[model samples]
Target: MLPPLKALPVFEAVARLNSFSRAATELNVSQSAISHQIRVLEDYLGESLFQRQGRYLALTQEGKNYLDVVSSSLSHIARASNQIRGEEDTKIRIAVYSSFAVCWLMPRLSDLQHKHPNLDITITMTHGSPELSDKTADCFITTDTEKRGFEYQLLYKETLFPVCSHAFYEQIKNTLNVTSDELSKRLKDEPELLENFPLITSNGIYNEYTEDWRSWFLERGIPLSNNIKFHKFSHLILAYEAAKYSLGIALVNDYMFSDKDTHSALVRLPSHRIYTNDHFFFSYKTSRRNETAIKALKQWILNEASSLNTLA
Candidate 1:
């Protein structure tokens, strides 16, 4: 009762390209083969779909109408076929903050891959909170702001502090001709010590609660003057990288600075830890909580977090 499905693709290719020869070249068939299929399709519909002007081709009104339906149908078929073959099942999509992905999750991904060799994991990074309603990702690692329809598991809370490269710290100590303890004491007691250095801060957009430089300084009772030299970065990850290379001091959360390689390169300033109320959480749709891939990824993340806690 239906037109031949095989001829539709050939006809679509010819109609879209406006050249039977070009369509044959694209589809890896002969020009005569393309013409034959188009004729077969035209016979089935009882209509002339193309107007031939010597070597050129143009779609008739009916051709245009049929193309709209045929293209949409083919796309739907391809999607459904891929879905039926389990192409979508093997992937675990995770949404997370850009800074957390760069500084924390990326480093630990190798361990995850080693454990689950066949699993395909995809990462989507965001600066602010991602939309839960879009169904873009299977799970999210985000700050503990509640989403109404999602279930959350608390990962850990973070402590904020100033971090800088060892080279920069040594430069300050040598320049002041003081011991490490004295250098730390001076940093805490003398606001001028902080004022003398180039301070790095995140751009005041995205998540304002966690990334505000002015709030961090004000919380420690230190005044932030407009005249002080400051370097601003779009994301905390960029600021962290800059701090690692001795460019400037960056205010970072504990989790971002926890990697052994990162810790070796940087030192947290003394007497300046601020424990935040914002905890990190792993969240997913309550309805999809039982999905096998989602469950596996969730348990892996929890295990990784547990190891970090043990090491801490």
Candidate 2:
């Protein structure tokens, strides 16, 4: 009860491009071949799909509906096939936040590779949360949030603090004519001194626990003033970078600055830290928990997390 699967691809290409000639070129087929395939599909369906207007073509109402279904189905099939192929080759696909990918995960990736040279890992950076039902990635590293039907392991709980470049810290120290210890004590006692400098924070409304400047100040019972200068960035990584370049002081998490390289660039303010309820978690489908590659990755990630916990 199916039309030719071969013709379906040709029909979809023509419907998407709105031109048989262009679809033929894209598919590396002759225009006549494309026309024949479309005609065959239309005959099988017993309905015209496209409305012809001189040299141009447009989808009919029925064509639009069919195209939607066909496109989604084709894409799902392709993804499923690729996932199976990847699994056979011992590949692990990880979906993680863009900021974590750049700041935390990428820096530590060489360790993973050194430990498991045969394991092929693919990283997909996303701004939004991962969809576990989609089976898009074998694993996802994300902030703690309520979800059901997936196996998850805690990576680390993050602590927030105000951070700036060493140059900026020296500038503040010199301006106050205080030693490093004195500067720390003074900043702790007079937290309001932070308002004198340019502040950097995320423009995204992630969550209350995201540790933006407003939340950081509110946690300390010091109300942030509306008149204070701020440089808002679309992503946390950008804010972190701006702070590193001494553009402004940024509210950042402990994990992002954990590495010696990052810590060398930035210094956390003394005695001003906020602990977040949200923790980083490594999640995977329950069905895949026992798969060899998944199991290996899970163990490795847990070991890394345990080491971080010990250090913390």
Candidate of highest TM-score: 2
Q: List candidate 2 stretches off by more than 4 Å.
A: 1-89, 144-147, 205-211, 259-263, 307-312
Which pairs in model 2 have colliding backbones? Answer: none
Instruction: State candidate 2's TM-score.
Output: 0.70
Give lDDT: candidate 2, residue 178.
91
State the lDDT of candidate 1 residue by residue for 50-160, as single tens digits.
999898689999998888668646644654676678765557789988877887799889998999877799999987877653234778997746677688887877666
Question: What's each prediction's clash count?
Answer: 0, 0
What tens digits encode model 2's per-residue C-alpha lDDT throughout 1-312?
977899888887898788899999999999999989888888999889999989968988988878866865675566467678884446778998888788778877899899988888898988877765433577898774566757889988776678899899888788788999998888888888888888887854344322377777887798887778888788788889999999978887756776345436898777577666667889986756766667888888788667554434
**Which residue pairs in model 1 clash with each other?**
none
lDDT of candidate 2 at residue 24, scale 0 to 100: 96
CA lDDT of every candidate: 0.76, 0.78
